[model samples]
Target: MEASENWLVESLRLYQDFHAFDLSGATRVLEWIGDKGVFVAGYESLKKNEILHLILPLRLSVKENQGLIPDRDFKVCHGGFSDKPVFDLKHVPETRLLVTSGLPCCSLKVWQITEDSDVIKAVSTLAVPEEGNLWPRLAVFSSMAPGVLHGARLSTLRITDLESQKTAYTSGIGDSEVLSSLQVLGTDTFAFCCTSGRLGLVDIRQKWTPSENISPSPGSGGGRWCADIRNGGQGLGPSIASFCSNGQLCLLDPRDLCHPVSSVQCPVSMPSPDPELLRVTWAPVLDNCLAISGFDGTVQVYDVTCWSGVGSQVEPLFTHRGHIFLDANELDTTPLVTTHIWHPCKPRTLLSAANDASLHVWDWVDLHASS
Candidate 1:
């Protein structure tokens, strides 16, 4: 592991005063996209300043010397009704299109960044379910060359044209349930993890089907906590790393769906005994090593040779003092660690967000002293 010598800090200033309900510190980072070497992030802030407010997209630039800079000078893309917006933004890597979800009145909006105009021009807009809180899910399929681009709501997943708001393909997941996460498994396939503890495979080329499934415990805990599905593992198809309730980690191949190659129960003697709220991810560049973090401050790195292989657990490379420390009853109000986003431009570098409304950048560097 390597360490970072320099650190930069930038604050976008959520709002002068709280704007939302009692959600003074609830912020969810939806997407982080980098083009060439420049990076942009989009997230939703529930409390703007100090007032109860609607959600809106917060944008920032990642640069070496500039630290974190707000995209204030960039052209603003508008949609929906809420003056405040809750958004899901994704970059079409092929076309370089910026797609956004959740505006006061708008559901999905596509925009083109014009270099000459230094502005973001609205490309197209699509209508979506306006009844429930509509959060957009984004995924890309590369099977058909550049792959099919799609989005999923709580009940439906549909493909949309970048230049036209027309629906290319649409499938239903029903209205009574919620989708926890969505990942593009292949050129024509996608994996959906639902709040119902249901994991289903959707084929964009065919009618979406339950090609594979994993049921969690009944009630609210059955849904997946987090997922890492990409084609880097030793397997030929998509490999899944999902955190299930009760401290169980299940790794499966969505291509086979019939069974998981391996499963591991989180070791009990963790730094913190609280139920594990695990966040699992595989490095985009590294296939052998995977990173896992839990509700406690421990971060584990694993050499995934095989699912059931012995002597696989590598030592925990590092421990983080999670942003906040609190008692059991204070969990709800605790300054929870929300996410860890690896730097797209810098390998071995990571960014973390916490309930304290702060973002910290970490680099994997050796702390061993000289002899």
Candidate 2:
């Protein structure tokens, strides 16, 4: 609630279950495998000029020290591209679990991890075609189409059927501003935002034209570093939570992108370096709960329902400070949080990694009870 030092101090609570492990290098990307208690991550290479990737399974229960499980950790190959990879996972149908990732080398790949096995392995599927010589910057599976995959090549959006591997629709997204994030609002409907905080909604059923993007108003030129769309349910329509490079949190409705539902100044420290690196993620189990990170050592979880668009900024519900300590040995030091994510099923749980090769997973206390 109140934006006061006391509320901030009160929100600082100890970890209910803190488990951490350190690697030899920093982690660059992290994605969860649905609600399977498993996640995929990319990290720096211990080997020279090489990178290491992992698909590891982890449970939430923690007491003392916890490390990676043997034989369950699988290494993923980068497929010859040094650039960052964009990947997403689908874990339903329990029997068949798979992940889709955009390779830096102009390809979209699907990897399946088998169930009912003692040892886990990553099986590769056919790669997405390299159309227009554009590297597949992002790839995500469509909710309504089982074999259909929706992807983007920089500012161009491409929807294809994986079973046939044929493109269904292609269109340019907003004057080629370099889309930073894409979210599926419906099977053929979706939203995208550029690095400059320009948001647009596109429906594949309709022909995409310049008119699809509403002309942005003046003084609205800012980078929407990253964004997440909360699915339309729980008595609320689909909504977008975008964090800007200029230190503002914008809430947008998919039906209308030209006007923000609301805007609030974010919690960025003064003169911060590289604000574009910041990211925003919505909790799968909490409709109004979202987490924002990349500003510093800690990841802040805020309740948007409490934010006042006209009043002062609202304090975060819970502040995860585990990475600031860098584990038990290191204290009072803040590390750059490479990435943080909400548990697919656990409402208040979080998994975060730091640039120092440290991973911390904690389930913060319930907000209502703690507050």
Candidate 3:
């Protein structure tokens, strides 16, 4: 029995070493694109090396970084019932589903995926009134807090209860413009960013009017347009930050609930006069850095400090070529990068997807350590 136990321990050690070697030896790229935009959510299962990606194909395939996901080979939803998948969710490991916003008529669609058949099972179909176009954003806050998902349009931001499968709350937001980004900041509070350079705070628990019209700087030509609010590493108040249209990164202090506490301008020179930073994501483990993808086909890493102060001390740390284009006018040249995402688990790894149909991954190197 002693000898058998010893052999088992040695075999497990050998297996660990083999897995590590295999993970570092080669690189694999997973691509998913269809008529809908590519929006990906990841799940970590109990099985070792099990990677599952819920890919929503927008106009282009949105590919996720492999480093962020553990298991490599997974499912790719092609069709079945729904024409376009607009929303997807992967909050837990065991049970995962994809939700889509119905086209034309305006409805909510859900799907349960099975590996054995490689077919997406239509779970539930919910409906919404045809008010405007649906822009869906789903977020899982706390394990026990239930789930709150939202979608945007030109006129309003609608919230849906995932557990109840009903519209719990709706905010009549956005003047004549469209909302670009929405984020959950607190237990029931969500921050909505618009294309016309405005930020609104909605407390779903309250029926009163929400707080809106938050501009980062006076006469700064409104915010860059589309903005995403991210919690600083601390996961506390004043942790909120935004990436603007003008390539500026600013911090939003929900504690004050009035104005931004600090802001940081990007160091990279704009490729053109009308430059839009497509996506800004926080580095998972690196607290002092933020990753940005812009319209110039460049992925940049910035050193950030005092995220909620007058302005974050921003410094260009690294830059890599990206694949996306900012707009149609710059198509003759390299298109500007439109989206960037950091690996949820890997601190130094990033993925940038652009209109160029080219997805690139960046691995940040420690300059001092290498030297």
Query: Taking the tens digit of each residue's C-alpha lDDT, what string does model 3 give over 77-131?
Result: 4333334422233332234555544234366555666666645566776565565
RMSD for each of the candidates: 9.2, 6.5, 12.5
lDDT per residue for candidate 1 within 257-358, as digits (tens), equals 546556666552333233223466776665544566545433445545555722223344444432432121244554555555554544455555554554
- Name the candidate that leads on lDDT: 2
Can you write out model 2's per-residue Cα lDDT over 54-116, one digit (the tens) per residue? 433343533333665444333342222223343333332323434444444355554444444
In angstroms, give how far residue 350 of model 3 lies from its true place: 1.2
Candidate 2, residue 324: how far the Cα is off, in Å? 1.7
Alpha-carbon runs more than 4 Å astray in model 1: 1-27, 30-32, 35-82, 103-106, 117-124, 141-155, 172-176, 217-224, 232-234, 267-279, 293-300, 306-315, 322-334, 344-347, 366-371
Instruction: Give the whole-model CA lDDT for all candidates, comma-separated.
Output: 0.48, 0.57, 0.50
What TM-score quantifies how close candidate 3 is to the native fold? 0.64
Supply the global lDDT for candidate 2.
0.57
